[model samples]
Target: MTTLDPYLAARIHLLSGLDWDGIADPEARSRFDEYGRDPGEWTMPDVDVVDHAAPGPHGDVTVRVYTPPAPAAGALLWVHGGGFWGGDLDMPESSVVAAELASRAGIVVASVGYRLAVDGVRYPVPLDDVVAAWEWFVRERPAASPVCLGGASAGGALALAAAIRLRDAGSLLPAGLFLAYPVVHFPVPALDDATAAAMRSLPPLLRFPPSLIEEMFANYVGRLGDLPPLATPGHAPLGGLPAVHLVSCELDDLRPSADLLARQLAEAGVEVRAQLAAGMPHGHLNRTPTLDGVDRSLAHFAAGLRALNGAGEVPPDVA
Candidate 1:
């Protein structure tokens, strides 16, 4: 049996009352708020942060722009993750990721708050909000810099969906794609024996059953038959998308699909870099603030952005 890593076990224990059902429970938001919240002091780096709202398909959407110390030459549009039902710009996930990438990666980082599924918004609407933020960033913030798109979990999936929408709409393609353990399919398949066993070893709140995960998918994509390629990037054609950098958590249930994305991208002759963080669980980007694995993952994410964004070199270090 694969021994459960104590680092992941401890983090999982801290996340109580978080499950598929808890997302809709009266206390669901509170639990999600607590689970996704960052607990440490967040000091602003030597950069400028602008918080403002832009027009969206449904309503106004909030976005934060992080200007690096140096002149902005590259830009990354980052989407937050919440299983499609939860997460926001004010969450610790957004604040920490934006600061780390902007200061370390040396590129302007625009963290977007696309509407959530919990607010009665669905697939394309959330995706529309992301594109809206990207448009606003291009027009108002950093138009001259080379651009890349990235997201975490559902946000990652949305990033891909937005890219496809842009492609169909004849918008310019992004230089690269960086996804952190993204949810690519509506009904993510069941885990195999080894992965399922590894997941069971974790705490209850961390182990998501296939049924519960499907429910979350239902909340995002209303009709199963309407599952288009844009809804699930794994099943979509990879010809026109930018080079991909997919960083998946080792113990994450989404690892299988992420692997499929890498394989599909590669088979389609697209440049791809796929890395799995050893012994780490999904959402490590949000959960582990100071661990070496988290640092490495963030650094890799930045590296992908830098490769596409030009020479703004920053080495990986523990934060």
Candidate 2:
């Protein structure tokens, strides 16, 4: 049996103990932000950062650009995940990951602070933010060179959706996609018997009740019937998606959706790679400071970025 990382368990427990019902409250949101664990950072390296607000449909999206030492391998526009309700660019996943990818992969990392669904923010608002941020990056950087797109959880779904949208518009498609436990299946479905049984057996910190997801979906997509394949991507056609690198958490209630997406992408003849964080919880990459699982996921992300940059090949390594 795989042992759960104690740090992750404690973090999950802490989050679970919070008055989650108050998450939509401003003060409660602040408390949740403060209570979050320290997002890990990469070892120090020469990196130049420029943070600014770019034009968007609703307002402006904040974007942070990280430039690392020497020649650049390629560029990536990374989005942060927080269930479409919360999260920011300063979080470890965005800040630290960008720094690390720039240093380790020699890629320019543009971390986006897209409009979050909380504070009365809505779906298309967040999606609009990502589109604006990406457009700005492509315009500012090399339009000839391909840019990879990446995100975790909510951000991941947006990344894929945006890529598809771009394809439809005959715009430049994302060179690749990095999705970490993405919430693609909007209008979250009821967990099947087997998955439900497995989730029930998980620790309180790890167990994801269907009610929680239902609330998130309601808060995100106000009208279930209005959900298009672009908004709720689980059922979206995977034919045109770029090579995908999807990471799933073993204990996540969202695994089934990820698995479905992976299989569908493969069936569509898209190059797909999937990895699971063994004994990890949902949002495992951000739940702990730096665990073995986090390292493993990051390594896969780095390798994928290199391949997207045409620097190497990512062989079939899904499990």
Candidate 3:
């Protein structure tokens, strides 16, 4: 029996006490209406928020732009995560993540509202929305606004896939990648027997069955063969990709995917930095209130963006 970390254990207890897991999307949205209200919230005296809309495959996608207290030298193109089925642009966790990145990285943060798969749009739909958002950022913002794309889980997968697409299209590559527990495989591979068994025995955050994962993948892929490599960066050739900063939690079922991608990227000669937050579970980056690991992850994310922008060496404290 693997025990949850003390902080994480308490968090699990708290989440179980809530109605978040079973509520309808609309009802859940109403309950957690504002960003930075839950775990991602940290005190950042210097931060600004603005609402922006960009043209996407699905009409206009709303984006919440986070401006750092300092003058921004660049912008971060951020995608929010919800298993490709849930999440909105202004969700509390996403907002806190964006604001943390903006404040710590000293850059502007554009939180993307990509189309959800279950809500109508499917796999490539999210990718199209990401690309459109990127286009809008480059077209509407300063040419010098170096853009780095990042996201958590599904959003992270989209960032990698989008980067691959941009690279193939001969488009300007983002300065770097900030992937937090990204889903790399399109039909996300099944959890190994050990991982699957462990997950079944763990707390809610640490438990994700292989069967459920298969369902998610099937839903997203939808009987498509030769799905674009841009839909799953792990399948794409790594050559010519930007430097990557990937964060993975040890208790996450997707840690294997992150580890494999990191090894592959490094072997292919991409500048890669992989950090493993031991004992933390999937989406730990969203639990800023209880986990020291979340704060470190955000700080590292900011530092990685800064490094790509020629802002100096990554601060040693960020690990």
Candidate 4:
């Protein structure tokens, strides 16, 4: 058996005792707040964040815009990675990602807060919010300029789904797509295996059951068999889609699905690039200090954006 990494084990131990179900909405928000409360400290010298609220189909969706040091020629609409049930607009890990992307790409980065599954908002609701946020950015934030869409995990899935919806409806396509270890399919064969094992080896809270995945999907999708290509982007067509960069972790359950989509995109003649992060876990990007995978991932995204926006040249660090 593989020995659990010590840091991962410690994280698991901390999470195990926490009662996620019993926590009130305000408490959960407080916990999320604790993770990334100080945006000023979180911001790098090259990064500046603008907090804005835009109208959505449901209501106003909040977006945190990240501006890099250089002139902003284009923008990336970033979605945070929470398995649909949890996560907020200002989580530290995501904030760090937004800052890094803005700094590296010299582009405007808009981190979005779509409706979460926990508050009766589910599937298409999140998708609607994503689209609404994208449209709002294009209409309101002229400084953001030419736009692209991207996200991690569930956010990644939503990014692709939103792009597809936009393309199908004849909306302007983003310059490119960026996804990091995205969770694309529900009732997957076994995504939580490594995550579950990580929990068992580390402590207790870190170890979650595969069953919970089912519960989350059911709640979001409203039924077991009601799956649509939009919800599971792997099953969707890719012809005429914008250039895409999909990053997946070696130990992540979403690896296989990402692989399948990569193959499909290639077969359809779409410009697509996918990187598999060896030895990383499902949410590895969030733990940036613990993992260097996102470094390479963001550098690649920077290069891609530069190329897409005619922003001059790709950075030397990108492979």
Per-prediction count of colliding residue pairs?
0, 0, 1, 3
Q: Give the Cα lDDT of each candidate.
A: 0.75, 0.77, 0.74, 0.71
Candidate 3 off by > 4 Å: 1-3, 10-41, 186-200, 224-226, 315-319
Better of 1 and 3 by TM-score: 1
Query: Which residue pairs clash in candidate 4?
Result: 9-202, 16-205, 199-207
Could you tell which candidate, 1 or 4, scores higher by lDDT?
1
The digit string of per-residue lDDT tens for model 3 on 87-158 reads 886664588788878877788888898788885557788888888988887776676678888888889989
Residue 297 alpha-carbon offset, candidate 1, angstroms: 0.6
TM-score of 3: 0.85
lDDT of 2 by residue, 188-230 (tens): 5555676566567554445556777777777887765667677
lDDT of 1 by residue, 19-106 (tens): 6545677676665555444445446667789887978777888889888877458888899898888888876567778878888778
Instruction: Give the Å error, residue 105, model 1.
Output: 0.7
Instruction: Evaluate model 2: give its lDDT.
Output: 0.77
Weakest 10 consecutive residues of candidate 2 by summed lDDT: 9-18
